[model samples]
Target: MRPDEILIIDRDTVERCLAKQDPVALVESMLHHHAAGGTVLPAEGYLAWRNGVGAYTRAIAMLGGSDTSSGRTYGMKLINASVSNPGLGIERAGGFTVLFDPETARPTALVEAGFISAERTAAYTMSTLRVLGPAGFDEVSIVGCGTIARAHVRLLHRYFGAVRRIHVHDIDPERARRFASDVTGRFPEYTVDIHPDVHSCVSASQVLVTLTVSDEPYIEAGSLRPGTFVAHVSLDDLRPEVFEHAQAVYVDDLGLVCDNPRRILGALIRDGRVAVPGTSDAPGSGPGRAITGAYGDVLRGALPAVRPDDGFVVSNPFGMAVADVVMGRAVADLARAEGLGVMVDLLGAATRAGGAA
Candidate 1:
């Protein structure tokens, strides 16, 4: 296998992969990977996401099909690690879609990425919420109108059908307006409100999902009504005091949150705060649902459900590679099923690739 080879696929391939993905297996694999001394370079974490994406996306646009810019190409590299002897069909960001592994690079397989970002994030969120407590939110206030913000709404919409009303507010009025229109247009049965400002949207909400990448906290704790479940996939979007009054704080990746620039849960973890299932010790699960400071522990009957007024429940995916691998495998199967991937024709050596790894 050569190091310089690249594999590529498109969006349709990702769809097939996700259709048969398994949540439990993926989560377990990720926990094992982290627990097994796997080093993590949180993508957004390492990149310092304040304004990194805005610049990166613009560079990508200028590189692709631009008459004014130089024809020089800037291909984005896919994050990788070899579990089996095989891994990755190359996946270029934006331009070259789908997960593809060139035979030379020894990439495991090409997979679809239809819901790669959203599903994985949602899976992590749901996993934390599942262990943390009940998330039977009827109506939700969403603060932020971006990709992950929309992902939160869509995924929640799938799980909690009772979410009939969504109060969406973005600093960008146009984006907020567009989101409300788009959501209502897609799901006519549900009513969405494009709040002119944050106060009108979040003041009395049961659950507030914050997806903005704000350096300053957008939603203050005093502003939040009692029983408001505040879960910000992005921490700085909400005020630090919000965590103080949180009855329950469910973080998917505790390590990520602890290291977050916002330091929302740093003090709590530092003080070795513990949570008893039924007690209102803030539904903060870390290290295991057992409070070890590892990945969250699983709680079946051991854990009590979320009450009517659990203040905050936040889950951070932190971009675990295992989730990527799990999703990668799913995409591979879909690619194989639909006969979409380029076969590794290493003569008889190709047969040896699967025998051991």
Candidate 2:
């Protein structure tokens, strides 16, 4: 393939490559690289509007780059979601990731990002769990039964062999049942129990993962048990009081989370309910709750892992674009090596036009 040609990796190819790759390791490397100041993560671009059917829809553009053992790579992920897509028999989220040449800053590849995005997010959750979750647990709870929930369960099954049972609760009972069926069909060694409500699921969980898209916070602090690790994937599921009472709260990035005032954690910082990390009134020093630190600190041994005494720990991963970029770059490399994906002469037309002129 020529340097000017751009490789187009479809969803199927990306999935095949990811199945053979270890996303958790990739995400861990990303966290470490980011911690070492080898990444550039700019503020994410966001836009939201209501659709014609009165359903909420939003688009996000995340730009980031990283320097790793593999090399230097930069990219942006543009993902969009509509709440009504599920009702229309379609996936709720879809997008693409574009990787650029590190030296030339020209586009090199376009990879389907919906699956990569979900997978990397799940990988991040698993990586965080290794440090913040209970040391040993057999039961885990999931609050939503959507695509993201499925990704998390798949990773848990693959990595955490101690988990034998999965407790799940969804607002729609049928969806929960479907999710359970899918899990059992793929991994028969596991047992899945569908709860009637979130309270029952939370009460039975050693680890709770929320994957809903609710605009309001519903999971109360009372529902959570001591030593429970909550992976708050979807930002707005947990109430403000939940954070206020948690043993410790870790985010992907301190500045990124506090800068975005739309999410619960950011809103708390904006409202003076939570103290930003590295400030004079850092978490635990002031009347308000304090942020423990970013996950990178834990990875780098700058912060301690969650202990048994740390009750109801929370990890708010304000999804980092660097993770997506690294994952996409890895998949692109794999595709290139295996001679997969289509290579398009993206700049050929322009080059020819210039020559004619």
Candidate 3:
């Protein structure tokens, strides 16, 4: 491949490549690398504004790089979403991921990232479930019935053979029913039930996953049963009290969770209820509550796995960019091997045409 050429991997190719690879294993490996300090993760760049119709729209640019035994790779994922998208018959979030040449810092490939983003987020949930979830859980509940929730259900069906029943709820009852129908249609072995309210679904679950886009906290304390595991994927769905009362709380990254001002945990930190992990006043050290540790810590065996007696435990993944980079790199490598993407001479065209006047 020429330095001036860049591979453009469309959504179809991205999906195909991911199908042939093990996403959960990839996420686990990335988490291990992150825990070992083999990654560079910078603060995400965020921009939000109201559209012409007074609806909220936002874009996020996350940059990350990793140095592993195989090699070093860098990438960025730019995802944008609008609250009004669903009404217009479009997916709420979409974006592309750019993989850069490690040595030259130039673009190597651009892969469709919306699917990758959802898959990685779901993988995070599944990875945490392996360590923090109840053993032999036969049922699971999901709070949002959107794209992310679909990804979660798919991964759950793939990884957890014992989960035979899925309970789902959405603010829109129709959407909930549709999600249930889709799930059952695709996986005939599992039964999907739609609940009219979130609480009912939560009560029925041994493992609960919240994937809604609500900025307000509604899932209050006591919603989860004893020995339940919660994957707070949406970040803002759970009330602060839930975190305050959890038997143990684990996050993808301590600094990332505390740094984001929009999430519940960050607000708790600001209110002085939750202390930053590793500090002298953190939980178990003082009166303030503290996070147990990152899931990476658990994956590396630095932290103990959650037991049935742990009560209601929560794992909040703040969505790391390095995982996206790792997945993008994997897709790019597979695309290259199979010659799946279109190659365009990004820089050579202008140079060969003697520059435009």
Candidate 4:
């Protein structure tokens, strides 16, 4: 294969090739590897433009680390999120990932990332549950009914085998009903019900996952039951006070959180209202001290959740670049092995040969 040639894997091919547990396992290994001091993740680049109500675009770019366990590979994922896409009967988020050969610094493959993002997000949630979730739980609640929420439901059903009930809530009642119907048709073993409100949906379940796009905090403080594991997938759905009241808070990366201050927890910490985990004199002090550990630490068992009066254990993953890149690399490798995707001269002919651009 030529160094400048790129493998192009589209969304349909990725959906077809992804097995039931591929993303979950890949995300688990990457998190463990990252915490083991084998990965390098720089601060993510972010750009957002606001047009008007229900109109905006957010572009994100970040490079993930080399996968030493899988032959020194690395990648970068670029995502463009348009809030109005769904109104046009399209996916709200779309992006592409570029896998690289670390040794040569040559781009290896370009893969569609919208589906990959959902899969990785779901995988990350399940991975966190494996370490932080209460054992032998019966019910789980999800607060949003979108593509990512659907992925989460599928993963939670697969991982939380003992949970018999799934309560879902969405601002759009029709969407919620549709989500419930789809879930019921797919997984008949579990009972899928739609709740009219977030409080009822959250308070009733042992595990609560929030994926809403609410700009303001709708997850009221003191509403969640003690011992509830809340996975806040949407970065800003919960109030800072919610974190202040939680027993413990875990994020995907401290740097990512600290950098994106607009994120609920990030804002609290960045404004000095909440201190970073290791910097505090007393753990869980004030509103700013809630963030005590990262998800990687949880996976390493370095940070254990200590229940305090049945308060919530909040796990916040701000969607890492490494997760997307690693998963994309794995899917790209699979496509290569099975003779999938189109090989195109993305960089044109090699510059060394003086091929005119």
- RMSD values for the candidates in order, in angstroms, are 11.4, 3.9, 3.9, 4.2
- In Å, residue 223's CA in model 2 sits off its true spot by 0.7
| TM-score result, candidate 3 | 0.94
Give the better candidate number (2 or 4) by lDDT.
2
Which pairs of residues clash in candidate 4, taking residues 3 or more apart in a chain or in different chains?
A: 226-310, 273-288, 274-288, 275-288
Give the alpha carbon lDDT tens digit for every residue of 144-241 in model 4.
88899888877777677787788988988988888888988998887988889888998887788898877788787678887778889996888777
In candidate 1, what are the lDDT values of residues 117-185, reduced to their tens digit?
556666665555445534465677888776556656666666567778888888778778878888888
Ranking by lDDT: 2, 3, 4, 1
- Give me the runs in candidate 4 sitting further than 4 Å from their true place: 51-54, 281-290, 305-309, 347-357
lDDT of 2 by residue, 1-357 (tens): 457878888899999999999999999999998988989998889899999999999999999999866899899999999999988877899999999998788888899999998999999999988888888888999999999999999999889998999999999898899999999999999999999988999889779999998779999988988889999999799998988888899998998898888898898888778887766554442257789988988998888887435468999998998999999999999888777887777666432211222
CA lDDT scores, all candidates in order:
0.50, 0.88, 0.85, 0.79
Give the per-residue Cα lDDT of candidate 4 at 57.
Answer: 83
- The local distance difference test score of model 4 is 0.79
